[model samples]
Each structure stands twice: as C-alpha cells, then as structure tokens.
Target: MTTSATTNAAGVATERSSRRRGGLARPTGIPWILPALVVSVGVLYYCIGYTGYLSTLKWDGASPLQLQVGLENYARMFRDPIFWRALGNTALFYVVTFAVQVALGIVLACLLHSRLYLKTLYKVLIFVPVVLAPATTAPVFRQIYAPTGTLNTVLEGIGLGGLAQPWFSNGTFALFIIISVQIWQSTGVVFILYFAAIGQISPEVIEAARIDGAGDIRIITSIIWPSVRGTTIAIAILSAIGSLKTFDIPFLITSGGPTYATEFLGTRIYRISVQYSDVGLGAAFSIVLLLLAIGTAVLIQVGSRTREEKAGV
Candidate 1:
C-alpha cells in the first residue's frame, strides 16, 4: 500500500511540473515584430522629413544643396500662374474622366454580363488596351491625331475635311486630345473592375427579381447598384487620384505644346527640375501634389465611410 501511494505522489509531482512549464511557455508578444515595425516607420519618417526640408531651400541640385532659404520656393509657387492653370486643368480632367469612365464601365459591364454570343472574344478585346504599355500607346495615338494622321486622312476621304481641324496643334484642342487618350486608355481598367464586381453578385438575387416581374433596368437600379456602391466609390477615388498625376501620356503626346497647354503638375515639375535646373521649386511642387493626393484620398475614405454608416443605420 505504501509503495502504491508513493508512486501516485510522484505522478502528481510530475503533473504539477508540466503544468508550470506550459504556463511559462505561453507567448507574450514577439520581439522581432515590434522592432521591424519600428525600423519601417523610422525609414518612412526620414524620407518624408528629408523631402520637406528640401522644399524649403533654394537648391539648384548642384553646388551645396543643403542651403536653406526659408520658404522662398513655396512663395514663388503660389505666385506662379502656370501652377494655378495646371491645378485647374487637373481638376477638370478628374471630374470629366471619372464621370465618363464610370458611366461607360457600368453600361459595358451590364452588357457583357448577359448571355451574349462571343462573350469571351468581347472581353479579350476590351481588356487588351489595359495591358498595353502607356508609353507605346501615347505615340500611337499621336500618329493617329497628327495633322496628316489617319484620323484626318479618314475624314478627308469621307469628304469631311472641314471636320479635321488640328487635334493637337492648338492649346485648347491639345488638352482635349490628352483627355480623350486618357479616357480610351483607362476605360478598359474600369470595365474589368466593374465586370468582376458584377459577377460576384448572387445570380439567385437577380433571378428572383426577374421572376417578380422586375425588368433588367429595374433590377440593376434597385439591386446591383446598391450592392456595388462601394466599388463604384473606390473606382471614382482611384480615377481622381490617377488623373491628377497624369504625366507620361501628356508629355509624350503634346509635350506641353502651344504655350504650356498640357502643363500638368507632373510635367511642370519635370520641366522646372530638369529643363530649367531648378530643384527647390520642383520639390515644393512635388510636396504640394503629394498633399493634394493625400487630402483627396482621405476625403474619399471619409465620404465612403459615412455613406456606409448611413446605409447600415
């Protein structure tokens, strides 16, 4: 009896030791994760802080760039008329492009979602432009819109030579052409996004609406629209930000021709920094554009969140 009791006591001692060890081994947050996050944040802070410092100085990017001038560059930026013009042009591009792209994307998405023939072929054709390099497309369109280009050639052939005014020859028309190219290049992306969003929608819900005598238009308006409202908002916000920073297409096609007609902030910064050899002012413009982008993004997020809350409540 004593032998059995001693054995049971030993077993209890082992169980207590194991429980103590298990309790001690429980995780108390990782050491490496916090340090890595700190390093990442520090690097980001340094980059932004350095840019801000550079914006205040009058650095020509040569011969002592660390010199400070106390906001002279920023002051000059405010007085620059070209900056204001670029800002206005950017705003106009964003508004017009966002409206047209979203409207056309929804229409196309709805059409392609149906049981149409050649659906795969249609999708491939539509998505082809989205994958092409923007640089290649810019020059291609330039040829198409040039004075003696295919567009004018086609118009002349149709005996509509009067309709073929210089598409990119003048200031007003150059901006218009740039916007047109942007619309053409970007519409495919919008279509693909909206098409995917629509496909995610439950077919049962759509069928139920149809069975209840709801027409296609009615079902789209009452059901699909609400379901994809988040995606629509997201697309609008993305288009707005993208339009503001439009550079390569405009630069390659128009080169800010006809007295700075296509002078967006991006192109303007490049001209000042590279062509005129003024680094400080260009840095200031870069800072301004970054702030504008951040502000617009935040506003979009806030507006979207408010709408979501209202819908939920």
Candidate 2:
C-alpha cells in the first residue's frame, strides 16, 4: 500500500515536469529562429524600402548629383512605348505558354499514369528540359534557328526550303521562339504537378466512371480535370508570375530583340538599370513588377475561390 502511494506521487511529478517543458518549448523556439527572421524580414524589407525611396530620384547609378522627381520615373514609364510593348508581349507569352504547357502537361500526365512501357525512361525524357539551364540551352537553340542551322537543313531536306528563314530576324518570329522556349521549359513542371494531383484521385471513382460507359475523353473531362483543378489554378498563378518576370531565355536567346521585339519587363528593367543607368526608372519598374505579380496571384486565387464556392466544393 505504501509502495503504490509512492508510485502515484512519482507519476504526478513526471506529468507536471512534462507540462512545464511543453510550456517552455515554444518560447525557447523563438530565439532559435530569431536570426533567420531578422535576415529575411529585416534585410529584405530594408532593400525594398530603399528602392521605393530611390524611385523618386533621378540619379545615374554612379553619379552623386540627384534630382528629386516625384513619380516622374513612373510617368516616363507610362509614356514609354517599349514598356507597353513589353507588357503586351508578357500577356501574349503568358496565354500561349500557359495554354500549351497545361494541355501538354495534362496529356503527358495521363500517359505517364497509364500502363506504358519504359515509364521511367519516358518520365526522364519529359523532365530533362525542366532541369536544363536556360543559359546553356539558349545558345544551342540560337544556333538551331540560325539561317544555316539544323532547322533550315531539315526544311531543305524536306523540300520546304521556302519556309526556311532566319527565325530570329523578325520580331514576330523572335516572340514566337521565346514563347515556344518557355512552353518547352516549363511543361515538365506542370506535368509533374498534374501527375501528382491526378494520382490523389480515388481509383474507385475512375473505375466506376468507366463502367458507366464513359470513354477516355469523357473520363478525363468529367472526373480527372475537375479533380486537378487546384493544380491548374496554382499553375495559372505561377505562369502569370513567371511570364511577368521572364528574362533569361529572351535575353540570352535574342538579347531582348531584333528591335526590342521580344522584350519582357524583366529584361527591360535590367537594361534600364544597368545599360542606361536609369536607376530611378528601373526602381519604378521593379515596384510595378512586384505589384503586378502580387495582384495576379491574388486575382487568380480569388477567381478560383469564386468558382469553387459556386460549385459548392
């Protein structure tokens, strides 16, 4: 009886000790993460604040002589035709790349999910482009689309030499190439996303749909597409953000133009800031870019939510 009483008291003390440890753990964790929080929130927000302040000044990146020009840089951006053209290009690029990549991704995802031969090899091949560096592949693509390159060689071999032209010589063609390159580069990511999303769908539901005389297209449209709508929304947001700040491919492939024909906001901001030394204008552009990205993400999310709410999902 004495031993039992003693054991009960010991158990109560251990429980109290654990409760004390649990209570202290969360407070102690803040100190451990304080350094990372400071670096991320403190240093990052400082740069953004500085950039906002600098946007009101007209100063060559190096010169100390500064003119205070409130919103003049922004006004100049509004009047700049190149800026509008870049904005238009971004819109078109987003539409084309997003549509093509999503469709291709969905198709590839379905195929990969099915019982196919050499599945691992096919996945690797499909994903290879996503892993490749744009800087390395840009030069290769430039050569291929050159006047005397593999594309032209293939065209001539097929007796379609008339269609063979220097693909980068024209603005239209350059824009097309940029869009195509973007679509090629990002499709794998979309495929993987859809693949994972589709995998989560209940197999029983699919089988039931098939037994109900639903064809492949019917099953895809009625069951699978709706199932992966969240993934599509996410891809839409990402594609919007990506298209807004696209630089590497267009810059590396064509240097933003045969005449600024393929310019995007990212490349334009870069050239303004570095090449022309228009730091104020560049800062303004950067601010606009940030706003647009955030706005787009919010819009897509809201639209998605509205649709989901209407559908009672």
Query: Per-residue lDDT of 242-303 in model 1, one digit per residue for the tens?
Result: 97788898899988877888889999999998898888898899889989988998899899
Give all candidates' CA lDDT scores: 0.87, 0.94
Q: What lDDT is reached at residue 9 by model 2? A: 99
Q: How do all models score by TM-score? A: 0.86, 0.92
Clashes of 2: 0
Clashes by residue pair, model 2? none
RMSD of 1: 4.1
Model number with the top TM-score: 2
Per-residue lDDT for 152-229 in model 2, tens only? 999999999999999999999999999999888889999999999999999899999999999989989999999999
Task: Mark the 10 consecutive residues where model 1 has the least summed lDDT.
Answer: 58-67
Residue 212, model 1, lDDT: 96
| Candidate 2 runs further than 4 Å off | 1-28
| Superposition error at 70 for model 2 (Å) | 1.4
